[model samples]
Target: MKKILRLTRHALLREQDAELRRIFGSDLEIIQVSETVPDVARVLAIIEEHRPDVVEVILPHSLTAALTRAGLVIPIIRAITRRVLHEDGTKDAPFSHYERIISLEIVSERL
Candidate 1:
C-alpha cells in the first residue's frame, strides 16, 4: 500500500485521482489538501497525523521556497503543468501537458 498526500484544489482534483489510480493502483490512500500555499507547520501537521509516504505537490505555489528554508527531509513529487485553452476559447481541463515530474529527495548524503 502507498500513501499520497496531495496538495490541490478539491474541484480540480479529478485528474489527480485518475493518475493516482493508475499509478498506485487500488492499494493507496490520498489525503487532499486545499491550501494553495502550504506552510511548513501545516505540512508537518499533516505528515505527523497521517504519516503519508510521499507528498504530491500539484499546486506548489510557495511550498518549494518555504520547504527549502525549513530543510525538511522527505519525498516530494512535484507536478509541473500548464493550463490548456481549447480552440473555441474553452477551458476543458484543470491543467494539461504533463511537462515533467520532479522527484526531490530532501536528504543529505549519509556517510
Candidate 2:
C-alpha cells in the first residue's frame, strides 16, 4: 500500500479519483488539493500531512512553482501532456527532484 498526494483542480479531481480507483483499487490513499497558485500553502500542508510516496501535480504552472519552492519532501510525478518545448526546439529540462516523471501520453496508453 502507498499514499499519493494529488494536486489538481477540484473540477478534475472527480475524474482522477475515478480513474485511480479503477487502476489501484484500494491500494492508493489519495489526498486531493487545490490546483490554483494561491492555494499553494494548503497543498503544502496536505503534502506534509500525507507524506505520500509520490506527489502527483496536474497543472504545471501552479504546482511546478510551488513544488520547487516548497522543497518537496517526497518524490514527484507530474502528468505532463505537451512537452516543454524551448524556442530553439530543445525540450526544456524536466524537474529533477522527482524519482519519476509520468507524461500524459504514458498514462493514457496505460490506462
10 residues in a row with least lDDT, candidate 1: 96-105
TM-score of each: 0.60, 0.47
Compared with the true structure, all predictions reach lDDT values of 0.61, 0.60
Candidate 2 C-alpha error for residue 76, in Å: 1.4
Q: For every model in order, what is the number of clashing pairs?
A: 0, 0
Tell me the lDDT of candidate 1.
0.61
Q: 52, model 1: CA deviation in Å? A: 0.2
Q: What TM-score should be assigned to candidate 2?
A: 0.47
Give lDDT tens digits, candidate 2, residues 26-86: 6877777764645667667777777887787765454555566666656666543345888
Task: Write the residue-wise lDDT of candidate 1 on 1-111 in tens digits.
Answer: 888777666443567567766766778887777675546677767667777877765545456546545544556665545677899998754544232233334444778
Q: Cα miss at 78, model 1 (Å)?
A: 3.5
Q: For candidate 1, what is the TM-score? A: 0.60
Give me the runs in candidate 2 sitting further than 4 Å from their true place.
10-26, 34-39, 60-63, 82-111
